[model samples]
Target: MSTFHPFPRLPIELRLRIWSLTAFPRMIHVKRQCVGDHGEFGLQYMATSTPCPPVVQVCQESRRYAPYRRAFTTGAEPRYIWVNFESDMICNDGSHDLLNLEPHQQDIQRLRLPIDDELAYDYITIHGDQEFKKFTNIKEIHIAVDLQFAGFSIEFLAATVNKCFNGFDNKVKFLDVGSGYMMDANQLRILSDWKNYYSFDTHGRANVDTFEGAIRFMRILDNILTLSEMHAIDDENAKIKQDQQFL
Candidate 1:
């Protein structure tokens, strides 16, 4: 009901600072959708549940200061969503092609992907690890998992991590949509150091539909993966020692 008409009279530096503050991080959901029909039916990059950056539509001054750029192009469509690679995260549902983002791979700093076996196989076995590695600036890799799924075995999860993210130095985290906690890979390793870490009788089964329960489910998976890696290393060392005995 009330408006500040004199706001424009404020200092230019102060006005710019206000606009800069509006540029916050966002979770952009990207998925492939069927566009066109009849003569031309194809999948294109679609930003679901995301709106264009407000600064881009506020005014000419704000638009000029906006950090977003149109990215994720294809042969049919050259432009898609406006993304701030520095602060905004691109969340993919594993249906879109990673190669479509090759042009801006170096600019993306944060990415979220689903922890699905088929998706992992596509990236590692079909597409090859080099394609995923093109996003050279990634600082964090968030793996979305569903705690309710019974098929998420430790061996499968470890294989996915090893095959897809073996040499990645970036932070790997696990997130469940139903949970409030986001567990870091490093913290999982540390927590697994305790005795009887595999015992989760207090937390119940992984299918418990609760926030705290979801976190406990994810922790169990992380602990198993950590132990599996340690065992693999021990086996490798034993083989090397046995070979040296013969020499």
Candidate 2:
């Protein structure tokens, strides 16, 4: 008798389930990358426990079940993806046109947008809307505003919100202000007005003034984002089950 490898004989559905079970945690960091002077663009994710999981690289069958680089790559429509902006000019200039992400990427259900100051926010406002309108399935936008930047302007909040809803016809489910500087009375009023006007859910630190406050605020935001991703995944799984039953 010959010893056999039973894993390979498993059904594709089971294989995928196993792969998903072994998947690196869903909450992941993503960033933009450019290659060559011609400016070929690509998405890069922060290193994970197994950046290229053995499942993906092991064999053709298992590879099909592996989540490829696109899963969390910049333009890939991953389930839950986080992008943190610490600088106004770190990646692409706001003047740069939004990259043409795949339709699924545009349909990301959960997103953690960057936290930037006035200039960076302005850049996004000027150049990011066109790309944002493509996000048809966006359910939530978690914004992390960096309070350390003293140049934050009130206009950033309204402009960002408007851009997100511009052509999507209010498809977004929530506009969460996850972290930012402690708002003055006026800013708080504006935030209140927007929440009412947009009729969307929000969660975040209302006040973050000191250095210690900023650090603590970030930890809280991270936890919230993680929970959001978990909820989204559970919702998706439920939906999938429903669809399967319908079929």
Candidate 3:
């Protein structure tokens, strides 16, 4: 009898899933290699005013993930689509451009839009914004970056929360304030003001004021406990199912 070695092969979907699992793993590591590596332009694409597509391209290229880069690097629509949603992030250009598209083989998982103009966002929400509901399968989202002068604005944050959660009244599970340049009471309120909101990641200068000493340290423990609870329950269920198979 000849011993056989199983060849390592992953289905396209599985391979894509694995890639996404670590897609932005080093989210905290700011890659400063882009040309305008100075001031606000350093961390973002100045012209595009959007971070996801370009950031993904740069990182993918940095890792020599060329082919994958091209997969999303092209096409006018969904230039860089999140696999989970299979929905291309759309900029709020007066119309719900992304929502018009029909779902393909991949399931629509999430949706994102910019918090460009604060006033408009407020108007939409205050008037019982039915517009946001167009995002059919939205789940996870990245909204108004809080970083000013270079950071996300307060109005933008409020509107983003309202738009993404369908209302500011709802609770959001995961949120990233991300290197936002905090100044003034209004700016701070956006992060601290929310109710039932968890996870305050103060990665930028403003965070210095918010997360001092034990605050960050204790938060780390809380995160670990949450992770343990989630996984322990899943592991127990798997074990029970395995025993039932033998019985």
Give per-model TM-scores: 0.65, 0.46, 0.32
lDDT of 2 by residue, 13-131 (tens): 88788765555434333333345333464433222232334456667765555554334333332242222211111122222323233434554555544444455566567766676
- Pick out the ten consecutive residues of candidate 2 with the lowest summed lDDT: 84-93
Local distance difference test, candidate 1 = 0.62
- For model 3 the TM-score comes to 0.32
The runs of at least 3 residues in candidate 1 whose Cα sits more than 4 Å from the true structure, single-residue gaps closed, are 34-46, 73-75, 96-100, 116-128, 178-181, 187-247
Report how far residue 235 has shifted in candidate 1, in Å: 27
By lDDT, rank the candidates, best first: 1, 2, 3
Better of 1 and 3 by TM-score: 1
| Cα lDDT tens digits for candidate 1, 114-220 | 64445443554456356767877788878776544555443343445556666662367766655545655544444333222443456654343343453466566
Where does model 3 exceed 4 Å of error? 1-108, 116-129, 149-177, 180-247
Instruction: Report the poorest 10 consecutive residues by lDDT, candidate 1.
Output: 187-196
List the pairs of residues colliding in candidate 2.
none
Model 1 clash tally, residue pairs:
0
